[model samples]
Target: MPSALLIIDMQVGLFHGPDKPHDGERVLGNIRRLIQQARERNVPIHAVRHTGPDGSPIAAGSPFWQLLPELELDGDIDILFNKTRPNAFHGTSLAQHLRSGGVDELLIVGMKTQYCIDSTCRAAADLGLKPLLVADAHTCMDTPVLAASAIIEHHNATLNGAFARIINTADIQF
Candidate 1:
């Protein structure tokens, strides 16, 4: 099984400030665990950082645009993908990179459960890649209409068994 780990938008900006996602610390911890497991298995890890328009927190060159320090991207094996759209594959070479690496399956973990994480998972499936979403490894901020926990729950239920198989971080074999 050729597999890769796709971590989407786990930037510093999402962790700091008042707009932080719910259970962000736990999410980051889970993502770190996934990274460690992937490294041990020699599974490629690709990180997608979202770049926002000028003046936005995640704008290019902004401090927040970078991935969180907890994620050890110093390894030569780590790959980085930058995107402006919700879907990581949009305007990015994520699909090509995966295909080139002979990666048929993707383990997704990241921020904003209802946004980039959700979009990327669906896009991966649509692009003929099998995606396994790490249920507890993604998160989002509370919206005006729904709480962050609710949003997370909603996405977990909706995306699971549909666009991707939702698995717990511990349940992931690699």
Candidate 2:
């Protein structure tokens, strides 16, 4: 019943600049909080970065593709990998890493609730790795159809029970 923390795309490009992700400050704080708690408990932490095509904000080899400095990930992550798709497990070694590490439960938190968060939670479920999504730790900007908060709420409601067990940062234990 060992658990690991999966931090996806908490990169500088997404968090930096004037145009911020929805609830950026609080989300960042929550992520940082999780990392610290995980470290204290000696829980293995894995982080994934998304690499987009050239000229995109998160293009490979770009500064934006780098992890945020505030994360202090020097030893925060036990495994670090990259992905080109929304799902972190797609075309990546993430699943294998988790399997080999004996990680049965994954506490997921990161950017773009509708994209990476949703995709990874489902993939994790399909893989038989228990995915516990931190409800308030994942975030995204507002879309044309809905507000960011609404999107987070929607995903929380939808992903609960079936795809992942939705937990808040305060309630999470590694």
Candidate 3:
């Protein structure tokens, strides 16, 4: 089955601060590579942008809610979806879009390892779609309780091969 690359929440607000949870630059580089590969292979790429309720940092119409520049999305190569909740599947046409495009496997990547990344993966699995999370392609900032590295390691260890398979960029064929 053909796969669609789901690049979630690489928005401006997430990468704006000096203290980025995951190494923003490194994870973004991985996303860049994946996007390029997808384009080269004629695979579909979708970017999920998060918008919170009024007054939130990621509110709609704010520059902070836009995707970061590192991904270099082209109009022909990428599609954009607006998501109000953490799980992009909730009340969104993402599933329908994938199904219509004959995408059975989803390549997941983006911010907040413990939140959006985790939620979206589980939701996709529940919907019977194969989800492959690039282990090094997603990242979060360090929290007070655990370091950023620890968080990424924990999610990859616990989530990989259970809910989703955590593969690195090289593991991907396209």
Candidate 4:
């Protein structure tokens, strides 16, 4: 199946603030490697950035709203999608963009495993787009109820086969 890499909400703000995702550096490295591989294979790469209301960490126009510096923001090959909702396809041109490019599957990676990543995967499946979640390339901060690692594990286990197939970044093949 034709696939595009969908990196969601990998913004600097997620790394800042008092609460940050666990193993952020490692996750970033994994995502970077995946991006390089995707580029080498000429697979389309799309980045979805979350935009929050005013005063939020990811509010539009704020420094934190920008993508992390590690990402290669090449306009020629990489596409950017700004989203106000957790589901990147909600009110966004993501589905149309994918359809127009003949992309049938999405290799997903990025932040907030329990939120945007989870939402987007389920939404993708509903939209008839196969989603492959890169297990090691996504992260989330510890919540009051659960540890970050547990959240990641739980999502990977629950989402697999239902919404997406959870795979490691190193196992990804274009």
Displacement of residue 162 (Cα, Å) in model 4 is 1.1
TM-score of 3: 0.95
Q: Write the per-residue lDDT of candidate 2 for residues 1-174, one digit (tens) a residue.
A: 989999999998887855579998899899999999999999888888989999998898799899888888874346778899999999998888888889999999999899999999999999999999999899998888999999999999999999999999999877
C-alpha lDDT of all candidate models, in order:
0.90, 0.91, 0.88, 0.91
| Model 1 alpha-carbon miss at residue 46, Å | 0.3
RMSD value for candidate 3: 1.2
Give each model's clash number.
0, 0, 5, 0
Q: Per-residue error at 143 for model 4, in Å?
A: 0.9
TM-score of each: 0.96, 0.95, 0.95, 0.96
For residue 120, model 2's alpha carbon misses the true position, in angstroms, by 0.2
Query: How does candidate 2 fare on TM-score?
Result: 0.95
Residue-wise lDDT of candidate 1 within 69-159, one digit each (tens)?
Answer: 8898754679986899999999999899999999999999998888898999999999999999999999999989999999989899999
Model 2 ranges off by over 4 Å: 75-77
